[model samples]
Target: MNSPVVSKNAEGAYSVKAPLRGIRKSCKYIFSNIYLYVDKNPVYQPLQLWSDEQVLQHQAFEKEQGFELTEFKNFEDIKEMSCDFKEYGICEVTDGSLPDMTYHVSTKEHTLTFDVKEK
Candidate 1:
């Protein structure tokens, strides 16, 4: 059999690196598919996943500006929205949105916070 394409290493052996922003882990490609990684372990609920085409579009947009752009797994994460506004009546925190690398969610009238690894 062939050897593992990407065995574990000191920094975790893998050709593709996780996205440095809010994106899902479900959406994927051969490598450099941060969307796939985020789909598995998303910071926000409803787990926003992107298509390979979408990733390409986003990258292309950034390239047009001649600079690396921050990527988000889900569109909701990049937008200014708050699930808490309706769920927990919290005006500050929100759900489906990663704020400063943190995700706030409401469950049974209670809001919870989860730390995330976006990059």
Candidate 2:
């Protein structure tokens, strides 16, 4: 099994990819939202939600394979923290709300990195 890859692109978008395996095809599993943690503290004020359409699309893809990929674009809340190497980050994917079946997609101690710009 492959662990989730959490990265910040040059455009400052945060992307998380979690790989799943042995999921039943009949199961209509849906990922409610994603939570980003920096040093054990939540980054965003309000948790991000997956739209109904997005959830459906994700389900469709999961039925064919096993994995969920999500991206957060232009999110100011994570900008500074993502650029700081000293701060470790983690991405969690849950089926319902908190205290539910939460999957820690990223590494146990992953550090965020900024894209280097050549002068």
Candidate No. with top lDDT: 2
Can you write out model 2's per-residue Cα lDDT over 8-117, one digit (the tens) per residue?
77986666664322234665343344554433232322234343455556667876786565432322222232222334332322222122122223222334332211
- Identify the runs in model 2 with alpha carbons over 4 angstroms from their true place: 1-15, 18-23, 40-119
lDDT (Cα, tens digit) per residue for candidate 1, span 1-119: 12223334586423422322332466522322222222232233343334455556667989999987655444333433343323333222234423333222211122222232223
Q: Lowest-lDDT window of 10 residues in candidate 2?
A: 94-103
Candidate 2: lDDT of 64? 73
CA lDDT for candidate 1: 0.36
Q: Supply every candidate's count of residue pairs whose N, Cα or C atoms clash at under 3 angstroms.
A: 13, 0
